[model samples]
Target: MSTRLIIMRHANSRPESDTGLDHDRPLNEQGLAEASQMSQALIDRDWMPDTALISSSKRTQETFALMMDVPCEIRPEIYLAGLDTLLPIATGIEEGKTTLMLGHNPGCEMLIATLCGTYHPISTATCALFTKDGPHWVLESVLRPEALDRFKRVPYEVE
Candidate 1:
């Protein structure tokens, strides 16, 4: 069995005006719903992670909390980290384990490109699933909140 990696960007956060610090910004209401939707999608796809590496930022932490219940390590250095900071972590995952990395872009975006040779935008609440293929990583799927049916809004009728 090959190792699998799920790279995800934290859900949308409240503006810095509300938190006074970028690191302290919390998820907005829409972000909460997006997190919940993505959580179910992961479970349904049987992509539940065995372990997770999460950024220490409040938004990333909250995003992980709403999405998963698994062993996780919060790394302060992951906040707004780039490929130089994240690639080593990805390369070090034990073989055959599924690990999730919840962080920000363009680090998340950079990781996907470095591993898979393709770059997909890592938007709020977006997940890029990658599986190992021989000596390289293969991009499996990219899950976005906007593309999930559960997140679609039903038109309201005026009574």
Candidate 2:
């Protein structure tokens, strides 16, 4: 049995000038649009998640609301968490299920890099895909900076 982890960063945000609340900041126009595209990309790649774990941050919540859905639940630890916070969170996951975790920067990116043994430049609105093929969740391929970059790069020949 294998567990698939698709980790995604929230989409773009409006400048602070445009919003009053950082904690409740909703997605900007560009962010929403990008998230919609990301939703389609997920469907295209057949990377649909069976269950989702998300940061309690508004951005992560909205990203899931706008992009994809597979019975999402909120997890406060992911909000502004460090690398140390990730593996513990991952350990709780059951084997053989596909899980999507919508989280903040550095932590998610750092985990993907560490597990996949490569640099994964996770950008806003980007997703990093990894899998565990054993009873314990193990490292697999790292598809970093997904949805937008991978979808668009092939057409423009941007590697």
Candidate 3:
């Protein structure tokens, strides 16, 4: 049985405008639009997850809310989690199940590199899909905002 992982960075956050705490910063207009677009793209590909592990930060929550309609575990540790904090989640995945892990950068990027043995840029709203066969993880696809625009099935209009 193979386990699939969808690791992603939260969408664009609002510009610092007195959002005293970094954890409280919400998604901007563009972020909301991009999140909606990305959500539709995943749906079109039938890539919805059975479970989602998401950071407790406001932006991550908002991003998750905009994406797939799935059950998610709010992991406070994922907010600034390093590889150590993330590895356990990936390793603990049950066989033949899919999990979406939404988190912050540097760590998300590092996790992808460590698991797949390659470096890929993890910009905001970037989602990389990986599948584990036996003990080795292989990257399946990467969906960035630009890529979403090109692959989206439905036209998303920013409101």
Q: Per model, how many backbone clashes are there? A: 0, 0, 0
Off by over 4 Å in 1: 17-19, 151-159
Ranking by lDDT: 1, 3, 2
Question: What lDDT, from 0 to 1, does candidate 3 have?
Answer: 0.84
The true-versus-predicted C-alpha distance at residue 71 of model 2, in Å, is: 1.0
Q: Say which prediction, candidate 1 or candidate 3, comes out ahead on TM-score.
A: 1
Stretches > 4 Å off in candidate 2? 17-21, 135-159
Task: Report the lDDT tens digits of candidate 1 across residue range 85-104.
Answer: 99999888888999999999
Least accurate 10 contiguous residues by lDDT in model 2:
150-159
Q: State residue 130's C-alpha deviation in candidate 3, in Å.
A: 0.6
lDDT of 1: 0.87
Which candidate has the highest lDDT of all? 1
* Error of model 2, residue 64, in angstroms: 0.3
How many clashes show up in model 1?
0
lDDT of 1 at 20: 91
